[model samples]
Target: MPHAEVDGVRIAYLDEGEGDPILLIHGFASNKQVNWQYPGWVDLLVKDGRRVIALDNRGHGESEKFHDPEAYGAPLMAEDARNLLDYLEIPQADVMGYSMGARIAAFLTLNHPDRVRRAIFSGLGYGMVAGVGDPEPIAVALETDRIQDIRDRTGRAFRAFADQTGSDRQALAACMRSSRQKISEDDVGRIERPVLVAVGTEDEIAGSPHKLADLIPHAEVLEIPGRDHMVAVGDKVHKQGVLAFLNNIDA
Candidate 1:
């Protein structure tokens, strides 16, 4: 559980294994362990002979918490990821991100292409450009006194997840309010690195994997069968597809 002071926030991360590097970014309300370690992503990638680095984004996990909405945004958060790479002295690495993490990874790739060799967007697809619904309800739910009072289904689910993770609900609420900045279709199309857009077949929140893949010049799509947003992260199909996608890249 090493921590790096990037910009002004303290980002907590896990660095393991010892080959080519890959950086993992987690979703909203999730820490590095809950998103990558517990899900076997770190072990899977490490066993494949990769150096795995996963970070807890600002206001999540052990990272420094910021209650201000302005303190969070995909582009701003992407800076944290880039700074973490600089902190670790990794010139470039393959990057994978799930849900909110996917957005952060896209920004990292677009804003600092030199620092990312390949990119994987999981649990999010066309939603990257078309918008992933509204975050207001989710924010309200996180700030609500109790989950039982939440009426919106998506909001309730996010609130429940925040509670389950023992996250700082207020900080998460602020994050939800501002972190989802949609990337333009034009911007996504500009990414020159090889990309994989993987989303669950049943994921209503991720939009269409094909639609997103169609945007990136070198992008491909992987649809995790019989899985939805929440359960798709650790799915066998997802793990296999990602491994294959990573290995297929020529050194």
Candidate 2:
């Protein structure tokens, strides 16, 4: 139940284990539990002598909810992450984000490379640039209202969202709808630290994991065949890939 006050809101974070630090970021409409809990990522990283920080982004989990469209952008999300580290007195740490979290992690590396020692971004199923072009009008139509419509459209597939305790699903859906801001390819190119992008072979939303790796200079890509997004986070093969990446960084 630890919380960090950032941007006039309280952000929730789990600080566990000890040693070199690694922060885990979750995806859209997903809380830290939904995204990282099932994966055993916290235990996996801690077992490897790394402290894990699993954070609940604003509008998700126990964190504050901001319905303002501007509050949901990558810049705001990324800033919230750094702010938490600041509060915790953490100088620098490795960061790993999945799906939407990956997007913010990528931005964090680009914007504050000094704060992140290394990065592992998964569900790179699709590059941000590619996903930006996807149809958003459907989501935009329900930004301020149309709650049921948003749910009706994405509810089944993103059931974890529907299961949100209170304002989570609404706030998360608003965040997605507000992603009308243009993606900066340059920000992606500015990743100076070692990077790892991964995806399960079955991910459809983030399409072409290999292409994502190709775009990020010197980054490595690993595709876990036969595993979908959730499985990639929870499956043995995917966890091994993560450990391998972390080992390379420490090496």
Candidate 3:
């Protein structure tokens, strides 16, 4: 529940434990709890003696939710992470981002490579269409207010997360307008830190985010066999993949 004012926006983050610093960046429409805590990742990380800093980005969780597209720009988002690090007085640390978070992480690594000691990107995809996924089913879901429908279908647990960030039409529109960045394969290749790119095998975002890993010089790719983007974060297989990567860096 700690807040850090960075770049004129208030970011809510969990600053816990003591050891090598690791920043956890959640995805679009996801707060720290849903992405990390719900999946027991935050505990798993801190239990391993890592100093975990899990943040709620703008328009998500307890962070400021701005309607303006420009406020949520990718460059600005990356700067938010950098500013948080500055506020903590830490010069460098590991960064792990998922879904939309991964996109922002890529920019942070590209723009401020020196500040990142290592990086993790999951559910990565070059582009995203707000409602174009799954074709017919997605189209019907959109008609019935998919966000609410998802909550109703899945129960309050997941829907609450969607509502906490962007379960509404307006929020989704704002996310699509503001979240996309112009990172390319060339940009991916530029990160100097030890990198890990992972994606669920059945991810809805991109079929193969591991391709992104192949392009990055220091990246190791991980693909969880049967999980989708959403389930991947909670999957034991995904956890092991991340653990292995972090273990290598820790060594």
C-alpha RMSD by candidate, in order: 0.7, 2.9, 4.3
Candidate 3's displacement at residue 7, Å, is 2.0
Q: Could you tally the backbone clashes for each prediction?
A: 0, 3, 0
Rate residue 184 of model 2 by lDDT: 54
- Clashing residue pairs in candidate 2 are 125-206, 125-207, 126-206
Clashing pairs in 1: none
Candidate 3 lDDT, tens digit per residue, 1-251? 98988878899889888888999898866788889898898889889888999888887788877666667766788889999999999899889998778877878888999998899887774342122132223223323444555423323333444656454434434654667665666766777788887887777665456556667788787887888766788888778889899997678
> Model 2 residue 204 lDDT?
64
What is candidate 1's local distance difference test score? 0.95
Cα-lDDT of candidate 3: 0.74
TM-score of candidate 1 versus the correct structure, residues matched by position? 0.99
Model 2 lDDT, residue 115, Cα:
94
- Clashing pairs in model 3? none
Q: Who is ahead in TM-score, 2 or 3?
A: 2
Please provide TM-scores, in order, for all candidate models, with all chains considered together.
0.99, 0.88, 0.85
Candidate that beats the other on lDDT, 2 or 3, i.e. the better one: 2
Off by over 4 Å in 2: 132-155, 164-167, 179-182
Q: How does model 3 score by TM-score? A: 0.85
lDDT of 3 at 24: 89
Worst lDDT 10-window in candidate 2? 133-142
Tens digits of per-residue lDDT for model 2 on 1-251?
68888767799989999999899998776778767776688888888998889899887888888776677887678888998888888889999988788888887887888899988888864556567333354344334354445544434345434454344555766777664344456656667788888888887666677666666776888888887765576778778988998897678
